[model samples]
Target: MNVFVSLLRTGVPALGGWLVALAARHGLHIDGDAVAGVLTPTAVFLYYTVFRFAEEHVSPRFGWLLGYARPPEYKALPA
Candidate 1:
């Protein structure tokens, strides 16, 4: 399940690129290169944001699936 989600996250940009190319080929009057330039950053930010949200929200179940190990408890030093 986590692996599938990981693949989906990684696939969004490539899928966006393909969709952009499809639009370009259909007389959409959009520049594929420019669209890809915009999408790259957007995809990266979206990926990170979703990753963090999932890490915080669904972490207990998805944690090990994504190779994240819970950190060992630490004692605070006296101030």
Candidate 2:
């Protein structure tokens, strides 16, 4: 799971930047700096949401791959 999360953390930003670069190459009128400012935060939000969801819902075995001992649960704690 850690591996998956790590990959997402890195890959999302890289993919966003790559897309921005590709757009620039194709003569898109977008401002690279402005796009980067937007893309980076969006990627971060996506990565965080995915990671949190996986941590809560994925099987323990797969979670272990990401160094999670177990999937998170919503049960209430002892009073």
Candidate 3:
């Protein structure tokens, strides 16, 4: 699933956006494409950057917030 759909499915994270979109539709009015084109990348970058910092400085447990229940172990290939 794309980030927008995933965020919606996950709940809370996308709620604000949906609320804004609803308001904009009935009141302000903006193109859906305009919002989606900018929002997806911004959200992806912001979420990853913030959560990655938290995982490094605060606690590894924060990894779950990024969808990893357990951090993946890095393994080097055998030569």
Candidate 4:
């Protein structure tokens, strides 16, 4: 379920953005309740449909080209 995990990791932020846009469209201020409302199944479907394609073409790089380093919190996780 790597794909599912990846979707969840990305979907949360996209859902937030969708809620923000919905609020802005109606000239309403965004808050936690607004965000929750916007993050319905429809919003998640739209975000997943768009971002899955984008993610497919992007490659990961670590410890090269970017002077990459793992965060200390990452090391502490049980593996």
Candidate 5:
């Protein structure tokens, strides 16, 4: 389950980035490395935003789908 979750978290962004890069290369006539340079950070930013949102708003069971582990509740914290 963890492995699946991990893959989902990484694979989607990777594939999206690749597609974006490809589109930039072919459709926009951008260079390969330049397209990657632009899209890489964009993809990372998007992934971080999505996962953080999920961690805050979604159930812990589903939060793993975005690669977040829920923090312990207040009752579980040490004094």
Candidate 6:
């Protein structure tokens, strides 16, 4: 399950960025690498935005997409 979720989480956004580059190549005159360079960060931002929301407001299960099926380790500083 975690593997599937991880794959989807990675594959979808990457596919989206590639698709954008494809569309831009068809319509615009810009280079594909440049378009991907711009869209990659946008895709990542959007991915985090959506999944973070799902993880918080929707269900804890969504955390699987973000690789935190449970909370992280807690470390207290020395007194």
Tell me, by lDDT, which candidate is best: 6
| Cα lDDT of model 2 by residue, 1-79, tens digit | 5456556545544565556455554575677677666765665566446655675676435444333444443556799
- Per TM-score, the best of the predicted structures is 3
Q: How many backbone clashes does candidate 3 have?
A: 0
CA-RMSD of model 5:
5.5
* Alpha-carbon lDDT of model 3: 0.57
TM-score of each: 0.41, 0.41, 0.57, 0.34, 0.47, 0.56
| Per-residue accuracy of model 1 over 5-78 as CA lDDT, tens digit each | 55654555445545545554466457766766676566556544555467678775433333343322345789
Q: List candidate 2 segments past 4 Å from native.
A: 1-29, 60-79
What Cα-based lDDT does every candidate model obtain?
0.53, 0.55, 0.57, 0.47, 0.62, 0.66
| Per-residue lDDT of candidate 4, residues 1-79 (tens digit) | 5454444555564655576457554665567565556555456556545444444444323211112221112225676
- Ordering by lDDT: 6, 5, 3, 2, 1, 4
Candidate order by TM-score, decreasing, is 3, 6, 5, 1, 2, 4
| Model 3: residues with Cα > 4 Å off, grouped in runs | 1-28
lDDT of 5 at 74: 35
Question: Which residues of candidate 4, in runs, are more than 4 Å off?
Answer: 1-7, 10-14, 17-21, 24-39, 58-79
| Lowest lDDT block of 10, candidate 5 | 66-75
Whole-model lDDT, model 5: 0.62
How many clashes in each structure?
0, 3, 0, 0, 0, 0
